[model samples]
Target: MKGFKEFLLRGNVVELAVAVVIGAAFTNLVNTFVKGVINPIVGAFGTKDLASYTSCLKGPCETGPAGEVTSGVLILWGSVLSAALQFLITALVVYFVLIVPMNRMAARRKSLAEEAVEAEAKEVKLLTEIRDALVAPLR
Candidate 1:
């Protein structure tokens, strides 16, 4: 029980959980953009929704009253293409918006830490030399 609690509370685990939740939410935004904006432009070229684009493989494809597929062996390549575009957009946004900025911030932090350590070392060396000089005449 204690181990499980610790695991759940661990920083990496918590960060991962948050990331997953955020990613899921971000996916909805991406989907909305693609469906609302990109899809229409793409539709102007062909169908209104890329998901609606399909090719029959085995027999005549059948659609219900609402235009939903009832029976068919479809290639459904357009749906795949749409999904691939969504993935690409998500990747690009995450890379440019999150990853790139985070990396730059981390690098800045690392450089500052290194400078602090160096400053502390120099101060310590100076203090040690002062102590040596003060004690030299007495020795």
Candidate 2:
């Protein structure tokens, strides 16, 4: 129970939970944008949804009264295209808006930390030399 509590309170765990929530919210916004804006543009071309575009490979495709597929092998390339476009947009936004900036920030911090370590090492070396000089004179 104690270990579980500590794990839950860990920085990474907390940050991950926050990130999941934010990501879900962002995805919803993007989906809305695609549906409201992109879908309409696609509709102007032919169909309202990219999923409606399909090709039958086998027997004649039949649809029920409600437009549900009754029988046939349908290659729904339109839905695939729409999904691919959405994924591409999401990846580009994540890379440019979040991942790239975060990576750059991390690199900057690491460089500063390395410089500080080097400075500390030089100070330690100087102190050791001073101590050796004083002890040698006494000897």
Candidate 3:
């Protein structure tokens, strides 16, 4: 269908897919930073290591219900924390990289339009003055 084709080709859908992929990859990077870099350094003083900080009592992986979470230890809050941090970082990066630049481009275009309008107005004013001067002699 034409509508389906249009939807498939829409820029927003493509952009959103790209953003989701990038965000997923970035989250992995943030997890590495939190687990390898931040966790050990901070865990030295804390009660548990980053990996064990959020674990499941009876689950294969603590991030979520592994196969069948028998007990809900809820130590997996550490990964949640890492995810939240990643989200904040992603938002800031997107705002600065994409939104800010887009706004600036729009503002620049508006300024150029205003300048062109002003130039046109000046030209009209000069033409009117010349016409009045010529008519004055005739009067």
Candidate 4:
């Protein structure tokens, strides 16, 4: 019971849980954006919509007698393009909005903390010296 409580209260575990939830939510948002926005843009380019684009091979392919696409790179590339675009956007957002700013803020806070500790130590040393001087006179 105690171990379970400790595990539940651990800061790292809580942070990890939040991160996982956020990651899952972010992926869903990206999927929606890609499906709704990016796919149309890609579709506007080469041939039909990139989301539905497929190769029409000549022999033993789609154009052949009573043949279908029978699988091609483009078939898989639809989702790939969507995922790639989302990944690029996510990377850019993380770099600019989250990672860079977080790093700078952490650095600033660390310097401030170090400075405070150093000042406190200096004050303590000065107080100790003054106490020793007073005791010496008394001796």
Error of 3 at 30 (Å): 5.9
- lDDT score of model 4? 0.76
RMSD (CA, Å), candidate 1 to true, equals: 3.4
Q: Which rank order by TM-score, best down to worst?
A: 2, 1, 4, 3
Q: Write the per-residue lDDT of candidate 1 for residues 1-139, one digit (tens) a residue.
A: 9999999999999999999999889999999999999899998999979987778977888888997778877688889999999999999999999999999999999999999999999999999999999999999
Q: Mark the 10 consecutive residues where model 1 has the least summed lDDT.
A: 67-76
Model 1 scores a C-alpha lDDT of 0.93
lDDT of 2 by residue, 30-70 (tens): 88877788888999989888888899978999989998889
Better of 3 and 4 by TM-score: 4
Task: Tell me which of candidates 3 and 4 scores higher on lDDT.
Answer: 4
Each prediction's TM-score against the native?
0.74, 0.75, 0.60, 0.63
- Clashing residue pairs, candidate 1? none
Tens-digit lDDT string for candidate 4 (1-75): 999999999999999999999989988887777777777666677543555544434443333356444543224
Overall lDDT per candidate, in order of appearance: 0.93, 0.91, 0.75, 0.76
Model 2: CA > 4 A from native: 1-14, 41-48, 129-139
User: Candidate 3, residues 49-121: lDDT per residue as tens digits?
Assistant: 5444555554553333564445455556766765676677667777998999999999999999999999999
Q: Output the number of the TM-score-best candidate.
A: 2
Residue 57 miss distance in model 2 (angstroms): 1.7
Model 4 / residue 109 / CA error / Å: 2.5
Task: Indicate the residue-level lDDT of 105 in model 4.
Answer: 99
